[model samples]
Target: MPFADSLSSRSPQIPCSRRQALFGAGAFLGLAACGQPHLDAGEGILRVIGPWDLGGFDPTKSGAMFSRLQIAETLIESDNAGTPLPGLATGWTTSPDGLVWTFRLRPAVLFHDGSTLNAAHTAWALRRAMEPPATLSLAPVADITSQGDDMVIIRLTKPFAPLLHLLSHTSTQIWAPAAFGPNGDVRNVIASGPYRLTRFEPPLRMDTAFFAGHRGGPRSVKGSAYMTVSRMETRTLIAEGRQADLIYSIDAPSARHILADSRNQIIAAQMPRTLILKVNSGNPKLADLRVRRAISLAIDRQGIASGILLDPSLAAGQLFPPMLQGWHDPDLPPLGRNVEQAGDLLSQAGWLREGDGIRRRDDQSLHITLKTYSDRAELPVLAAALQEQLRLVGIAVEVQINNSSDIPLSHRDKTVELALVARNYANFVDPTISVIQDFGRGGGDFGATGWVNRPVEQAIDDLLTHGDPDGRRRRGIAQVLQAELPVIPISWYMERVALSDRVAGGVSFDPYERTLRIADVRLAGGRS
Candidate 1:
């Protein structure tokens, strides 16, 4: 990929008032000029800035970063539409009954440690990945074995249509034999990819260099120094100070803040992730269908998108975003603000308005606590907005800002009344898995807590096994979600990035966040 050299000046979803980066790019540049500690800008090293930190050595833990950086490769890669493509495995096939799958490995591929890629190594990696916590464990994988140097066989207990897509997960990234310790503890990331990990500082910085032995051949930039700057302000400063060539996972405010910089390019892609409000449907107070509908009706998604996200197009009317072509229902009624309807529903649910303006049922107030995190930066603000919005409908919402992990913890403990979550539809490569895992019999931590519609679950199940060519089953899943209001759709997500002018890029925004495709980025004056 050629580095970013001739990028056009694009406006953010919400244009900043030419505040000249109201946060002060001049101050950052001045500090850099004053010998403040800044980032790298060498020709050989592409300075990459983002919010993600290296979670750990395990793929199931945080291997997504390795794959995103092109430091690791999955057996099956995915296209923008989430279709399977050749990766470590050139091609693959299944038995007539779909019970057995065989993958023909790409030959002569060398790991960063100089070890050759083989089926035995790949099989070992897959088997290890089947351990709990990885989505692969969800599949009914009966056994895994290596036949020859290039062939790996996997037998399943039953036919699983999502097996291919499951393999596309970051947890399934093939690893070198030496990547793990004798007891199978992952010690390093030694995988066959365009980039290899040369330096890793847990939960913060990762430095990678291009591997000459990569099957893709030589890369444009010799390497990349990825730094995890969690603060949006600092990330904006890095983009303006020319400290980094590529900045990933930026927010709308940061995007708007840096939009005035003509020297860089703004890359915004609608992702498969959606910001949703997860409600505890099992809670006695929120279990009523009318109350749930009231909660949905009271939401002002358009106002949130425009005022907070600064992008009205990012407002979500349904559970699935437009990015998921088949899952998003075009004809289904969209969720919107209807204060009267919300109040009516609440009244029907036996909650009458009281003097405090909070609805009361038999002297019990219609009050709920909403939990959110600040990782995304917008969630806490959105939570506050939701609090105010619900207040108008005679519902009292208490906002609590906590760590991201607390949501799941509270879900498991059956203690959460409401939670603001950003659910990623492409987590399992196929969107159907999201429906199953989230709304299935057991339910997901970030999904509808204690809510299970057997018919919708079966519809999702049949979509995989029986095939839904007519999309009737898919539409049923969407309809059930819309009607049930198990998860209130708020806004869709956008992957915002700023590419520096020092390089020219043949860049593509990966909706799946599968790969950064840094390989195509090269020096501005370098050969194509």
Candidate 2:
């Protein structure tokens, strides 16, 4: 994927109240705040504000964003509970041997570029998805071939239970043949979906309109305009002013503030996401299992959840929240703060508290730097709380707030000691794959660094091979994590968005955290 130059078009960017965003001056920002449409985008456009920006034309990079907007789709789609639904691929079947699977495509589907979707093009897209760096590469896919104009067959090295579920990911989104260049690099986004791209400017703005050729609308909305607003403060003002129909990733403080506005409401849902401390286990100070355990024991999850996040139950008892059935084990002991126990553990690890109240083993100090990003709004605050809690146990911490992307970069370069991250396990079909990718073997960008447990690794392989119907394998992995404390779980996440009363169709949330489903909503009193 080469550099994607900025896209220029006549479509308008959704403005903010600050009037100083990359989207330009917000002269028409709060027009809809008064419950009326402005001059340009009309009453039908669903204007949205959020923190994520389009990475590029590369499907592997920014495909999830396209999926969230429903501008492009994958072969298979999933409901809130992860049940497979028909998208481009209407139906599929596995070979009796389980080594091969065939998918039947939906008939008469038209790409945005007026190209017909067939088995060949779909296979090409799937092959691209299997390339390195994409999530699909983790699967056992050997080859993808088109048997005919409508049927596509996938051959795997071995049987994978999550094959269909893997295809549901946006990375497998099929693009029109014309979307690719002669060198096979993705030049643009041209796919079959409910909407078509009207304009796109990387890192800031995107605009869309209903594709009349497809069989989707007369929907509640004709189109949507998205703008990346990184600051929670500016986003809250935009929502309070009704500048956007939907504003995503609102902070806890902003959510409580929005409740006071009768014309607006907070739309909240349980997300399969957990806030954890991404520990650099390779660091000499954190190498000992006792040191890591002491770090976990010192932090108070209950206090942080109640005071900072505003929900006591959100203080995660375990990494797997209750909503994540099969993964969440009730019998496992909950994670609680114990300062005396933490001090004891530190002493056992050869770290003795000195005169300055900071633990040190001779000259080596029990000190660490915690990296965090404000993308989720609660993470920086949580980092601060963790710092104070660790200080009580003579563990000194310095919190450094930086961009979310830096966490992965620092992890790769071995420069990060500890990072505060909110990880979404449901980004894939299930948490099973995520757990493996994160904590398995060599470790993932956001998972355990320089830490490996053979039993945990073996458990993941067992789940992959035999499939954990009773979740015995998953519980075993959890038990090891509870004892080892690779990454300390802080709290579970409830994805909250601030929506105006102007939005209709009940303001339902996509439990999968994929799409906002703007197509489902309309102006309060307007007909669909």
Candidate 3:
């Protein structure tokens, strides 16, 4: 009686319905349909390729693998277009007041271990994530109670417009209670995903198997094997040898070299991540608004973006990217390369050029340390470019490359002079939460100089806590943040994923990096 069986019984071998087929092919019918998919259970592993090693399987402590890797599924889900859809919850409805939400569970759906997925199980998972240790943001339920039979009602203290987006995130992923130990700690992951974890070795490889219990449409890749090759050269080698079905994280030159081979396919995606310079505006040396404006003017964003990143359009003029539609205002004044204006501003601010040609104030020379990291591969190069560009403006800067985590740690210690790091703004579908978390008073993990404008802060709070459609207050807040430039952007980054021409029917990229739906991805048999 379940929808899965109803759909399955009608056509077990077909992946799409007549409506879908018509939409895709415009009513054209094939002379002969494809045969039943022959999946060899022993060799049924679909090899997936990525960069990070599968170190942590637990979804709470480390969710990179759990969320990005799609090793688990959340109650509510999002389509490739980022539209809110259903996962474990077949359907949902809200009260007129919009404070309460009730979701209906899919019938007869079972976990990999053959346990039925019910309202009780779903509620338990939500409760666990809401507890102190996990502190998941999406678990906004003050209380959750099962409905008469198959439904679950969630009561929230307030209406959260982005709650559905939070549900699609990894922290809300559902897991069998038995997957954890008596201490309520996760030791393993027995989840309901397109792929299930079969073999895992810490900091190295993760091999996944197709879930036989999956009741979704036909998938091309029934199974997949994921392995991490850290060294860029090694990753290239793997792709060259066909040892890796797909390769990622290689530099521009390396990617170009790999793409030259006729046997491989290279895919480039505009990653919703921005490379920014974080400054401490509160520091007396940097407090003067003129100093901030002068430094912003001095940095040649176009030169750095093109010369160092090999992309001209990546040069940023504002804090947020064009892809972040709602918050980004195209009407703002353009930031361009202006060395003469920078020099004039510094001179007017009383920072005169001394005999040594370095700008000086009293006995102090204009020198500072710029901290960066080599992890992302391009940052150190950009840092070097920045060093040269800043020095040209009579500002002496020294560069240091450390671990990726050092940026935030240094910010907390107040030891960081200026930090150059990449931020992925697409983590949350709605940009408001990220903006608030980063720019609010005390600042969140990634912001610098504790940038706080009371008006901007209040505007964001109004949008998050209480704001209706056509919220001019939210727009005003974004405009203020843009004008102030809490975090100065150097360039917007694009992530590259290299795949062997053997794979087909896979979506290009999802900015959230959530799931790569491989069902339609089939191994190319030399030709389409």
Give candidate 2's error at residue 170 in angstroms. 1.2
* lDDT, candidate 2, 264-330, per-residue tens: 6676766788999988888999989888989888989999988888778789888888877788889
Q: lDDT per residue, candidate 3, 8-48, as tens digits?
A: 11222213344543542331122113321111123435555
Residue pairs with backbone atoms closer than 3 Å in model 2 (clashes): none
CA shift of 357, model 1, Å: 1.2
lDDT of 2: 0.80
Q: What's model 3's TM-score?
A: 0.86
Per-model TM values vs. the true structure: 0.92, 0.90, 0.86
Give the Å shift of residue 397 in candidate 3: 1.2
Candidate 1 C-alpha lDDT tens digits along 1-528: 122322234654344344645554654565468674555555677778878877888987788899888999889988888789998899998889989999999889899999999998789999999999787898889999999899999999888888888899899998899999999999888988898898898777788898998877777778888878776766776776677788877787767657666655667777889999999999989999999999999999999999898789888989898878888889998899999999999999999998889999996898899998988878988999999999999999989999899999999999999999888888777888777778887788889897878898778778767667788888888999999988889999877778777667436777777778788776685311
Candidate 3 global lDDT: 0.68
| CA lDDT of each prediction against the hidden true structure | 0.83, 0.80, 0.68
Please list the residue runs of candidate 3 whose C-alpha ends up more than 4 Å from where it truly belongs after superposition: 1-44, 132-135, 138-141, 471-474, 526-528
Model 2 TM-score, all chains together: 0.90
* lDDT (C-alpha) at residue 50 in model 2: 84
Q: Tell me, what's the RMSD of every candidate?
A: 3.8, 7.1, 11.5
Q: Count the backbone clashes (under 3 Å) in each candidate.
A: 14, 0, 6
* Alpha-carbon deviation at 355 in model 3, angstroms: 2.7
